[model samples]
Target: MENESPDLQLQGLHYLTGAPVRIAIRQGRIAGVEPLNDPPASLRQLPWIGPGFVDLQINGYAGMDFNTLPIAPHTTSRLSRALWSEGVTSFFPTVITNSEDAILEAVSAIARECEEDEAAGSAVAGIHLEGPFISPEDGARGAHSRAYVRAPDWPLFQRWQEAARGRIKIVTVSPEWPEAEAFIRRCADSGVLVSIGHTAAAPDQIARAVAAGAAMSTHFGNGAHPVLPRHPNYLWEQLAADELWTCLIADGFHLPDSVLKVAMKVKGDKALLVSDAVMFSGMPAGTYESHIGGKVVLTPQGRLQMADQPQLLAGSVKMLPAGVSHLVKRGLCSLGEAWEMASVRPAKRVGLPFSAGLEAGAPADVLLIEWGDAGGDGSEPRIAGVYKNGVSVWP
Candidate 1:
């Protein structure tokens, strides 16, 4: 079916207040929002209006893998359209650590897809480069190949940026290297967000990275050594840095509830959620071969771990909706707060227009959610409808 006409009105319960509202749309943006005076017999009959999710770190969805060598044609476009049902209106296709040439090809293909496909062009906020410039240590490196890991190389990054048509908005780096501070400063100055992740950096180095404009932390508390010094570790340093926004993978398996609560409390609104999901996100639970980890298993419980060692996680199989559900289920945060962390907050961090959410004059990138059971039951939100730029795109 074709999308709804740009000029239209949608009636639903407001996501934050749970009050009925009528949202006016015109010319692909929200014209106004007004509260409904009449009391409905059943609020469950109406969907909840909220911002469409904006994922800052997702490698792929369903069967598509962004980091796979020779990314298939239209893979980016297919991924973009696939995410609408998942309530993701926008996302950053993540390209992880690989050989210089492989990285270039992957990004260039994504850039081409954006240039050629209108839907992809609008949905792909930017490219998230998750490394070659990171720690070479075993645990901190996560699944990134150690052979490709090296010191921060601006020239090499520049080549990737050029291939991506300047769409590399975020770069994850470890501040452990001697040249990291300068590299981070350069990326910040060039309008790229520098995120600290998969790191073995000391407290001083982490502080310096923040001083040099490291704006965010990637999947905080996951990609790191199993053990750390009791004090003066990178985790403590990032939490103390008020300017650093933290992104957590609230997939339940990634971080414990206690840690999630503390980070959310410390970072407050600056705390965000990211799926950091891989190609197996929407696939059935089964054993699969991954480019990052040779063999991995997707458990029915939604945990993705190495086949050989179930203790080690390969990547996440859940999406943003599941993360929001986990946070709410764990009583870590309220439904509204959890939604914003996965939606507007992440958009706000990236300076995207979708940050305005249901406000007037913001782009009408919205989700109509069936959240009737969310208040008490802690079930995942059912995305009944998704609208991008005021046009209904999902059933």
Candidate 2:
């Protein structure tokens, strides 16, 4: 699969050259990349060339939720194909706050699908267990079920690790939770990525977690109360902590332009964009009942709000590409920088080796886009095409 003839050639697109370049693919890997003026006659002319986006945290898409109980056998594959259409070549199936049995069951089902097929774009690189070891406070916990939220338990984590068949990639927990630091260490020792989130952890706790191998702050600012005093809090503490990588849901509703700019300034290249999108995403704008929380509504403005509280963010209505677009639209970063936040940064977060933008000898996972005015409204970017392993997987 890795050693075969160059089957596809894409020409007239910029490579980080931001100037036109031609790319050739062989088998399932990149064969060559050259200036656009002198390309093979067969290469297809296109407008954009970039690395395919990789989402590190995505719950569900296209009306199919991964956390649905009595796990559906084909749900992962179905969602994977749907995400590929949206330019997500890879992602972690994030399962938030549920009973222990439900978590294990979900992990088992995902592991089965990953074991069955590697090409299934929704391959479970790892399970993002976002809760069960989180803040129990109402506003701090977001929409997670408080009954299931508890202190971190090593035995429980070990059981889940076994159930995932070693596919549990990242675990999100509150640093303030008792035993969280130890759990972070255990997760690090087992080669899993630990992320701090849904917490009121002080700067010292955050530092301790970082030293213990908790490397990320999940959706940094979205889960807190609407109003925060002008002093140190999880938000400001994380921003000041240089060792932490922050993941932001760049959906306009999750954060304001001002806060987004500050976060980008603090994290720089370490900032990653995630959808944190829920089951309601990819569905029509309307009221919907969530499995974890009560009824929620997707507003016409693309905000997902709690039916009881209009000001709160239920979850994100954005996807990975849109998240990147939000960063660029807000003038927080350039398109190339935003693209890296969605692609290379996430690929590195998940420990994938092929983080290079578009280069020869890299994986043939690429995205084609048609650029528009930089100041244009932040609508979802048009995906001209997506290639996975040198094969055209989306149009």
Model 2, 9-99: lDDT tens digits are: 8865563556668788887788888877865454433456788888888898867787889767688878877887778887899988889
Q: Give lDDT per model, in order.
A: 0.92, 0.80
Please list the Cα RMSD from the true structure of every candidate, rounded to 1 decimal place. 1.2, 2.9
Best by lDDT: 1
Listed per model in order, the count of residue pairs whose N, CA or C atoms clash below 3 Å is: 0, 0
Q: How does residue 1 of candidate 1 score in lDDT?
A: 23
**Which has the greatest TM-score?**
1
TM-score, candidate number 2: 0.93
- Candidate 1 yields a Cα-based lDDT of 0.92
TM-score of every candidate relative to the true structure: 0.98, 0.93
Per-residue lDDT for 1-395 in model 1, tens only? 25658589888888888889999998889999999777478978898888999999999889998988899889999999999999999999999999999999999999999999989999999999999889999889988999899899999899999999999999999999999999999999999999999999998999999999999999999889999999989999999999999999999999999999999999999999999989999999999998767899999999999999999888998999899888888789887899899899999999999999899999999898887857576556788999899888897
Clashing pairs in 2: none
Looking at model 1, the pairs that clash are: none
